[model samples]
Target chain A: MTAAPHPGRTRRTVVLAALLALLAVAMLAGVGLGAVPVGPADIVRAIGRALAGEARVPGDAVIVDIRLPRVVLAALVGACLASAGVLYQALFRNPLADPYILGMSAGAGLGAVIALTLTASATALRFGVVPAGAFLGAVLTIVFVVRLASLRGALDVTSLLLAGVAISYVLSAMTSFVMVFFRESMTSVVFWMMGGLTAASWPYVWMVTPMLLAGIAVPLLSTRELNLMLLGEDRAAELGVDVERFKRVILAAGAVLVAAAVAVSGLIGFVGLMTPHMVRLALGPDHRVLLPASALGGAVVMVLADLVARTVLAPVEIPVGIVTALVGGPFFVWLLVRRNGHR
Target chain B: MSVRLAYEAATVGYPGVEVVSSARLRVAAGEVVGLIGPNGAGKSTLLRAVTGSARISDGEVTLSGRSLAGLTPRERARRVGVVPQQVSATFSFTAREFVLMGRHPHLGRLQQLSAADTSLAEEVMARTDTLRLAEEPVDTLSGGDLQRLALAQALAQEPEVLLLDEATSHLDLNHRMQVLDLVRELADAGMAVLAVFHDLDLAARYSDRLAVVAGGALGEAAPPPAVLTAGMLSEVFRVRAVVGADPVTGAVSVTPVLREEAVPAAGLGSVLVIGGSGTAAALMRRLHLAGYAVSAGALNRGDVDQAVAAALGLEHVALPAFGEVDPRAEAAVARMAATADAVVVADVPFGRANLGNLRALAEVAPRVVFADGFRGERDFSGGEAARLAEGLAAAGALSVPGDIDSVLAALERFTAR
Candidate 1:
């Protein structure tokens, strides 16, 4: 154990480099593999003209207007989901904890259903109503759960999980009621709940990007504080950490990021839970490196999962959530089996 | 020379609960004070209060006339270093890294370590002899090693006052002596070191002053000789003992009295226990507890077994420091064994010291030696016992067995008249 170049740090840097390369390749592949297949040379020419302000190629408009925005949005949302996952893991100290583990997705889904009902009567729900409603729902659910768990002036992870479970059931029930009540918007509500990039657009990306960046940055800065906290709240206090204040700040920032990602992408499962844990196994528990590594890893996992969802069946796209859940469920099972076997 | 730390009618405990109420005591610098008491006497709590970890309910804890509340944790670290009893590491840091963390208070947030700070840490490690295990994980080290590591870490901070709770309970004889020597050395170097020790002999040996904490308050703190008295030990520890000193070093060693156990009378045998101080206490207790009529001579007072004989009201002939064994003491041992069936000698250290006493006892009775005598180990009193055993065995009057159990087993085989 000759201290392997701060193994965690080295692994993280290598993983980050590999992820950047993967993202570049995925961007190229995403542009070239559609029904009207565009060659890389032609796409390169189109991209150059777009950069040089001289685009008049025949199919250039479709490629730039249609395909590029969707792929770009896929990458952005993928990065957002992954970064949110890392933040949630640090806040919960549980490798299995993700943003939706707190029931935010169920809350957001219920909000989307309500927005669909409002849009039936008026079109005010068109531009930002869906994401805005989802964001509000997520924030409200987080506040409720946090308040419920902070009854004794100290927050406990178990109580928070229990509160999240309770709210998730409540919201899921309400979402089902809206689904049955408005069968006309059943297709749209169903797609939103299953999670997809079918509605991915430049405007949606702009709306969620700021919240996502802030969310990632805030958790990254608090990485040192998080390291102290892994020893438990009381011990952390003895070492000069103001635990209550730190907890409040982390929870609020983590909630904002989770809410924004949920608002835009609906409920993309596993991206948040799986990426952070995989990073931790390679990186050790120092949040300083763990947080940034998780963010990069999460982005890579989400982007790849989205690629498979869009291309595996080609013309007929699969719901991105189905692919993630299929992957994450078995990964989680293996983790549990290995952990129990060791014990 | 005098730095005072004390409690003035102070009550201390957790939030809204008082474990120790109205404790009063004054501990002066340059005086190594000990706090001893029964369990739940709030001794640990008092230590916490002094370190500003626990809140004082009523009065304040002051150091050199300044309230402890006025000092920041960094200021306290600079002046007072505390070694908590239940020390555990959450993360596996190397011994050196753990020690370096003690230097946190001295350095500012962005300040790089100066050469002086680095050298100070090295010096403390060398002084504590923990530098050899500097790169080993704190979790993997043995108890003695961990204790030394803890002391080194506390010393690295270079504090003026050191507070240790049960620091030496895990050490062996050599380590105990080593740690105590370091404590005294530090104290002599003008750092006030207050340590808690369970070993009565150790506390009496190194501490200039001892204070007992019992019933949630501090008892009288005074010099070891004055504090570790016979009456005080009997009252404090709930055991009877004759308190005396080692003739070689003048350090206090107690002889405890064991309660007598009723045994059926067997053949009469006069047994002489020839063993060093405390080792004989267990044998004497076992012998007396079995209800065998027993007597011993040249046995030191304050030895645990001497106290056992006194408590059992046995016929014990003891040697006094003030005078030699008179005609009556020797004559009494002979008279008591005149009609006895057998004689057993324990593994007593034959000192150039106790040679005459051994010679006197060998003159009478069929001597049964404790088996350890023939092992030919280094003799405490030269080779007198080894030579005497040969002569007595040649005469067919002495028998040697392996251990305490074997000697007692052989004694039971001889039928009483």
Candidate 2:
């Protein structure tokens, strides 16, 4: 059968285009507004030369080497987290669900702290060891929580959330124990826990791109199922959805997205939780539209947050996570108050 | 007249506990069958079995001779559509979007809804009269509106068999009838419909057949007139009710007997009431409420007093309607009055038909209390009834006003003795 024109198709397209434009502007500002500022023309030339594989200019290293990878990495991590947020919110059928709600951040933090304490050399810590450890820990924690929550092959959302909370507390306490004993690694562990994109590189951007694409693509393909899931699992099942298998697929996808983002960016907060919620408030909750809009909205928020993180403190950089929370916290509250007032 | 849906000895429940056992039923291609029961009698479980939500451990539920256990959820949904009791949506979806989700089972994994599907959704929405709320968010709609939208969504599935699990409980009376009318129209178009209803009257009105679930077993499915009876109402529902045909709709009507308190076992002894043509209905109810074993005599069959007596589960002597009190009925009334602690003669106007009731009261005059209010004009036997009443007064029969409270007070004095 031929595909019908959706009623919200035009509005979704317009919202997506506007978000894409906003993301382009945010990336431009991120690249041009650092301590050693570059002009728009210079930024364009730097990107062009980098794409053409030409010889480097005097200002090319600053734009191409430093700001470009960081901005791109910020955008990827933001999209990954936001898409995860959308999947999770639909999976649990709760608007409050987010990327880190299943204890992924705490698990990653614990793993990163363990790696920092074990490795005597800071160079090894900076290489792939810490991120690999974080990824492994996050996935393991999610699997354990899922196993704990499932009974007779049915995954109970309430039990899953409770297990996540319990496991998060235990892992966080272990991380604190490691930090207290290994005094030399304390500052590094603290910095990682606060989260930053200071370790951004071309390799890191290359690593996250495919996974981020998969994260976004999976939710986009399953938008119909996700919309059905919002009514509830039982209702979704009655509508011919294989609810248990669907939950597993979504939970696995969300776990991978969050774990990948956490491995690269440490424990960034609020981007996942706030971005999807903002998009849903502006655009309605048709996952066909909400998923794509949230991906773009999330990328815009993170790129801007990273821009503030590097520039607001000048030479001494604040963690990007702190910037997001400081900005996202107030904006989220304002949205809630405005929505309540309308109601 | 093929059976589209059938439950052949189905026993449904979750893992060890059986909620419903040995349920056998069938619905033809163009019939509406209603399932009724008290709370937790497994009415919903039977519906769930059809949707494959509950497992049938014993026999099987079949759709058009094929077992439902083997069909995939999409296949089952394509054939059987269910409108559940309620749905709590966590997200804000427009009414149109919500209705479009019903086309999910028909669409393939990657297939978008075609133009045909969209028009079908619109058609169902119009049929359910919810097209005006298409753009409104479902969460913002009232309960009745949401229920109609749910029906629209279910209809959009285009299933051959429709199951409603108390779907109309949230609707107002007008909307309830509107929805049921739409359902009837659908059944007339040859869809098999099964609905669970807590409202007995509605079930009786709309159902061509009804299946009763009680005490974990399924009763026989029969026509509404056969299923809804005073005996069944008292036995299964534990309430006294009068089951009759509605004068307006020609459907079986059930009027529940509302008891203020449980009638004690003749705490004030038995009271025999003599009256006809509704004069003794209130007095019978008041006496029954006061913990007396109340009996009425020589009440014409189909009289208001006879219905009240039957509804109250009181022993009474009934005669043919509009006929003179026969000798057999008068003897029965005399036997009841002889055993009663006191007899009450209600302010019934004397006529040729019920002059026998006054004569029956005269045999036990010493134990009788008359609520006659000294009205000699009510004697239509031309002073023959007035002369008998004066003779009863002379024999020490107590006289009280026609009001119920004064008659009750006079009976209280007799009980004090």
Q: Give one digit per residue, the lDDT tens place, for model 1 in B267-362.
A: 255555544355566666666555456665555565555555565455667766423446666566555554445555666555565555455555
Residue B268, model 1: Cα distance from true site in angstroms:
16
Interface RMSD of 1: 5.0
Task: Pick out the ten consecutive residues of candidate 1 chain B with the lowest summed lDDT.
Answer: B258-267
Question: Model 2 chain B: which ten-residue window has the lowest total lDDT?
Answer: B257-266
Query: In order, what DockQ does each candidate have?
Result: 0.13, 0.51
lDDT string for model 2 (B1-417, tens) is 999999999999878889999889999999999999889999999998887678799999999888997888888888888889987765678898899999999998788777898899889999898988887889889888988888888898899999999999999988999999999999999999999999999999999999899999999989999999888888888877777788899999888764324655657778899888889988988898887878998888777788778889789877777878777777888889889999999888888777777777767888889895547888998887888788888888988888988988889866764
lDDT of 2 at A171: 88
The deviation in Å at residue B252 for candidate 2 is 2.0
- How much does candidate 1 score in TM-score? 0.69
Clash count for candidate 2 is 0
Candidate 2 lDDT over A1-343, as tens digits, reads 2234565677778889999999999999999998888888889998999999999989899899889999999999999889888988888776656656577777877876776667757664544666666766777787787788785478776687678778888988998898999887788667877889998889889778877776567778889999999987777878888777888778767766776688788888778889999888888888988998898888988999999899987998999999987876686567657756966
Candidate 1 docking DockQ = 0.13
lDDT of each: 0.68, 0.84
